[model samples]
Target: MADSVGFIYTFFLTAAVIYVSAIVIIFGVKEQPIRSKEAKRVSYSRKDVLIHIFKQPLLVVTMLLTFITQVGNFSIQPLLALYIHDLHGPVNLAFYAGLAFSATGLGNLLFTRKWGDLGDRIGHDKVLLALLILSSILFIPQAMADSYVMLVIFRFLYGMALGGIIPCTTAYIRIKAPASMQGEVLGYNVSFRFLGNVVGPVIGGIVASHYGIPAVFYVTAGIFLFGALFLWAVRSHAKTNERSV
Candidate 1:
C-alpha cells in the first residue's frame, strides 16, 4: 500500500480499519453488569485505586512487564526497514518489509487464544514468565538472521510469544483485583504501556544511530530478559511467603 499510494494514504487506510473495528466494538460489544443477590455498593475512591495497585505485588509487576514488553516490541519498528535493506539489499524492499512486519501479527492472531487457554489451565504468572523469556530469545535471533525469510520466521514466533503476555497480564489483574476497581487498574496498566510506546521509538532511534540497527535488537532482548527475571523473583518470593505463613 505504501509502495503504491504513499505512506500518508496507507496510514489513512489503516485509520479506516481502526474506525471500523471501533464501530464494531461500540455496536456489538455490550456489557450488562452482573448484580449480586444483596446488591450492596462499595465506594472505591481513585486514591484507593492507586494505593491498592501499589500494594498488590502482581499488579505492580504486571504493569512493569506491560511497559517493558511494549518498549521491547516497538523498539524494532523504526529500525526494521533499515535492517531489512542492509541485510537483503535494496530490491523490492516494500513487499519484503510488509511481509516481515505482517508475519508477527499473523502469528499473534493464530496463537494468542491458545496461549490464553494454556494460562487458564496452568497459571498466568508462569505463562507470562515463559513468554517473556521466549520473546527475549526470539529478539536475539532476529539480530542474527541470515535472510529475510529467517527474520520473518523469528518475528512470527516472537509474535506468538508476545500474544500471551496481554491475556496473562489481564487475567492476573481480573482474577485478583476487585470487580469495582478492575477497569481503573487496567486503565493504569494501559497508561504504562502507552508511555512505553512513546519512549520506545526514541530509544530505538538513538541506539540505531549510535550503535547501528542490530544493536537495537540486543537492547530489546535485554529489556525482555530483565522483565522475565523481575517477574520470576516476585513470583518466587510470593510463594516463599505463602509457605512461611
Candidate 2:
C-alpha cells in the first residue's frame, strides 16, 4: 500500500515536471527560427547514423562503458532486499531494501547536476576515471559486509560514486558527436542503456541464487573495473589519434 502510494506520487511529480518543461519550452522561452531549405543538409537516416557512430571510436567506447556500468549498478538493486534479509535477518526487509534503492536516487538527486558542472569545469575523462575508481572501491565493503547497517553504508558510498558516471558519459558524447548527429548518437546510447537494464537483473539474480549475494557486489566491481580499464585504453587511444592528426 505504501509502495503503491509512493509510486503514484512519484509518477505525478514526474509528470508535472515534464509538463512544466514542455510549457517552458513552448511558451516561457524564445524559440529559434527553423533553418531555411538552403541550409546544409545532414543525413540522419538509420544506416547513415550507424555509419557515423561507428566512425567515432570514442563514442563506441563510451557506449560500452555506460552499458557495463549501468548493468552493474542496476543488477544489485533488485536483489538488495534478499541480500539484506540474509545479512541482518530484519523483520522488515522490504522496507530496508526500498531504503537501500532509494539511496541511489538520493545520491543522484544530490550530485548529478553538480557532477555535470564539475565535468564541464574539469574534463569528462578525469571525472569519469575518478567516479569509476571510487565506485569500484566502494563495492569492496559491500561485498564484505555482514550486517544491514554495513551494507547500507557501502551502498550509499557506491551510489555517491556512481552519481557522476551518466553525466560524464553524456558530456563526453556531446563533445565527441557532431551537432547534426547528436540525436542519433544519443539514441544509440539510450539503446545500450536499455540493454543494460534488461541484462542486469537476470545476471544478478543468477549470481545471487546460485553463488551468493556478495557475488553481486563482486561481479559489479569486476564489471566496473573492466569499464575503467576500457575507458583508460580509450583515453590513450584518443591521445595517440590526436598526436597522429
Candidate 3:
C-alpha cells in the first residue's frame, strides 16, 4: 500500500517536472528571435573545425574531464534507492530516496547559474579544478556511510560539489572554443554528456552489485581524481604554450 502511494507520488512529481520544463522551453523559444546574425554566422567547414579543436589541447582536455566527471556523478543515481532500502529496509525508502536524489537537483538549480557567473569572472579551469577536488574528497564520507542518514548527508555535500561542475564546464568550453566553431563544439559537448548519462547508471549498478555500495563511491572518487589530474596537466601545458608564445 505504501509502495503504491509512493509510486503514484513519484509519477505525479515526474509529470509535473516534465510539464514545467516544457512550458519553460516553450516560453523561452518564443522570447528568442527566429533568425539573427549570430545564428547566421554559425557556419564553419568540418575539417577546419576539427583541425582547430585538435590544435586546442586544453579544450580537448576540458571536454574529456567533463565527460569523466559526469559519468562518475550520474553512475550512482539508479542504485541509490536500492542502497537506501538495503541499509534502512524498504518501508519508507521511496520518500527518503526521493529526498536524496532531489537534493542534488535542488542544489544544481540554486548554484549552477551562480557558478557560471563566477567562472566567467574568474577562470573556468580554476573553478573546475577546485570542484573536482572537493567532489573527490566528499565521496569519502559517502563510500564509508553505514546508515541512510549519513548517506543523505554525504549526498547533499556531493550535490553541492556537483552543482558547480556543469556550469563551469560549459563556461570553460565557451571560453576555449573558437568563436566561429562554437555551435559545433557545444553540440559535440552535449552529445558526450548525454553519452555519459546513458552509461553511468549501468556501470554504477554493476559495480555496486559486484563489489559493494562503497565501491561506487570509490569508483566515482577515482574518476574525479583522474579528471582533476588531467585538467592540471592541461593547465600546465597551457602555461608552457603561453610562455613559448
- TM-scores for all candidates? 0.93, 0.83, 0.87
Error of 1 at 186 (Å): 0.2
Residue 214 alpha-carbon offset, candidate 1, angstroms? 0.8
Write candidate 1's Cα lDDT for 42-116 as tens digits: 758899998998887878999999999999989988779889998788987887788888999998999999999
Report the lDDT of model 1 for residue 70: 93
lDDT of predicted model 1: 0.91
Model 1 bad stretches (over 4 Å): 36-40
- Stretch of 10 with least lDDT, candidate 2: 34-43
Q: How close is candidate 2 to the true structure, as a TM-score?
A: 0.83
lDDT of 3 by residue, 1-245 (tens): 23556567867888899999999898776664436575476677888777877898877887777688779988888888888888788877778788888777776777778777777888888888988998999888887888888888878777877889888877777777766677788888887788888878888988988998779989989889888998998899889989999
State each model's CA lDDT, in order: 0.91, 0.82, 0.81
In model 3, pairs of residues that clash are: none
Best by TM-score: 1
Q: Give the lDDT of residue 143 in candidate 1.
A: 92
**CA displacement after TM-score superposition, residue 99 of candidate 2 (Å):** 0.8
**All candidates: CA RMSD in angstroms?**
1.8, 3.8, 2.8
Model 2 stretches astray by more than 4 angstroms: 1-41
lDDT of 3: 0.81
Instruction: Please identify which of the two predictions, 1 or 2, would achieve the higher TM-score against the true structure.
Output: 1
